[model samples]
Target chain A: MTREILAVALLAGFGLATGSVAAGPAEDLKVYQAYFEQHFPDFTPEDYTRGMYNFSQDKRAQYEAIMEFPPYEMAVEEGQELFATPFANGNSYSNCFENAGIGIAQTYPRFDAERGKVMTLGMAINDCRVQNGEEPLDVVKGPLVYIEAYMSEAARGKAIDITVPDDPRALAAYEEGKRIYFTRRGPRAFACYHCHWEAAGARIRGNELSPARGQAANFPAYRSKWGEMGSIQRRFKGCMEEFGAKPLKPGGEDMANLEYFHRRLSNGIPLNAPNNRF
Target chain B: MPYPMISKNVALAAVFTVMHVVTLPLMAQEGKGASAAATGNGPEAAVEQGKAKAIELCQGCHQFKGADQAGTVGPPLLAMKARFPDPAKLRALIYDAQKASKPYTMMPPFGRNGLVSEQDIEHIIAFLYTL
Candidate 1:
């Protein structure tokens, strides 16, 4: 009896020591959403799609006013034209996506079983270009941002519905992404969880840190600072630079996996992308 | 044309170049900390400087008891003299917080990053003690 009790105690201690709490995608979604909800009791999950604007009524009002005359309207038009243009091999971007890539942005950072890797929408766009005998666009910015902005606009109001398959590789990818979220790095020695999780809605200097929950729902947003539309990967690179860390490649495996886990956390939140932000 | 030999030679050159790039910064960083000792400031002057530095940098996240601007991001820094009786321990926490506490601390390693020097931290410690 004594020996059994000691063994159980040791196992429990080891589990806690290793920080090896088992968490699946569903559990992660629940925990992250619950955390944000607990922090911002007044906010609905949909409110997070606006990022920092959710924290301040003044900012939200400004954001809403800007939305009435969205700066990205012309970019979205350009993106639609780009999407419809034929490649040298006479294949349109429509040939490469389901439902002609109309309203499918919410299903991105998906586990691609055939490729044994995660596939972000930008990667899919590049794959389409390659398949259609056209040179791939820059994954981080420029025309790709406009194209993704167009797709994001189509996906607005759709609930984010990312899926992590039961395959071991898919699970592994998700696990890697979760690890990246929690791992501390760079000169600051901070993880994504520190600001987004522990200090969600807390003011850092003059800026309010956004909760990580529905941050993925809006992307390829038109940042007032950039004065242009940019993708989520571009934002990731910028944040990493602030952390004083060498950023992972845009559209690379690590970033794709990170987005997979991030978007999964935002499961069921309505997407509101191609939005303006200050 | 010996294509494989050329490729192998190029690979070797690339490897050497990467090694050179990786080591140069580290070599440069080794010589940094020697000049970071206390500047011979009076106790009152040091405290004033420390208060200014804390407001400029630390106040953004940490709320000091007497500070006008409050931030709720990190824990409120109060009762510092009681919490850190030893100034060295406090200095270590400011230098590399991840090393002192858990790995996921949001506190920037001010000393490690050269954001604050030893003299600056010493002054900051003086201000903390006042709290």
Candidate 2:
């Protein structure tokens, strides 16, 4: 009897220690659990078994069928043709990048020290156009969407690997981007952090807000409200309007810099574009 | 000669005394005005009056409780205290409410309809601060 009691006590002690470890930091855990309970109550450890995984085959097919009717899919198909088509000078877009690599879509919003700017993948594609002596495609226009979809399709299996360089200028840009996100602006006086970072997972106008982190991985999404396809910058513009602030033009420097900051938040997340979102 | 001189001095003193006495209420009114300007209310009674007016008028739509109403006709005022902590900005929002576009078309203007006086709006803001 004495031996059994001792064993029971030891087991209880072990359980308590394990429970405390699982609890984590109280404040972080509280908000994290609150959001999880509200948005994804059914989510489990099994859901995260893989580092980055697509939906099951059936689910993927369902989403694909939904995308078929949208005009954006047509844009992506057009982009694919354009990628292989030679420019008037006989230089193909595939040859413009180093090593003729097709999977360079994910390493964008990179710091370009020569220009002292954070260059998005869309911007890089247009830059390639200029080098080829063709009129650069407008980044905000529908043509860019096709080009992006085409390039991203080429990078289907490639992992996202954007590096924030250790250069002083690059570091300064990151810090500036972070500041811009946190600083309150407009008549409503709301900062990006107030909604996405701080109040994430909370209900806003009957919608569950996703955390700003791990956001860049999914883009070129089919927004149910928009009833069409949109890229990250388009969503950023919508958020600005919601805050009662004037939105920056799509493909502008500020948008690129902001994307650079947002991408850093999702450092290791895999790129999944043209995904469905509500 | 002595009687006339005494009467003349008495008349002048009487005139001056009457003038000072008549101006005493005006001086008191000025003091009250200064205090009212400093404290934003002429007296404590006015603030009480304003609170009563807010409870009657603004409480219908701006539910002070944090619970989700069946129909969220207007934006919840529970987190508003935190959202608009600044008193001046809060006052501006109430007084110049048209600056914000409503999600629905039916929210009527309280100030424009003369349902709330400027003083009542100030008091309602004060009451919101307490919440």
| Candidate of highest TM-score | 1
Fnat of all models, as shown = 0.65, 0.00
Point out where model 2 deviates above 4 Å.
A1-72, A99-101, A157-159, B1-131
TM-score between candidate 2 and the true structure: 0.57
Query: Per-residue lDDT of A1-278 in model 1, one digit per residue for the tens?
Result: 23223222222243352255565777656755666676677877677787788778998899899989999998899988899898888889899988988889999988999999999999999999988788889887788878998888888899999998999899889878877776666766667777787677898877788888888888878889888988888888899897678898897899988988888888888988887878
lDDT by residue for model 2 (B1-131), tens: 11111232333224334533654454355443334433333334344544555555544444554223212234556555687665555554565444333211223344544444444455566566545
C-alpha lDDT (0 to 100) for residue A3 of candidate 1: 24
Best by lDDT: 1
What lDDT does the true structure give each of the candidates? 0.76, 0.56
Error of 2 at A108 (Å): 1.0
Going through the candidates in order, their DockQ values are: 0.28, 0.02
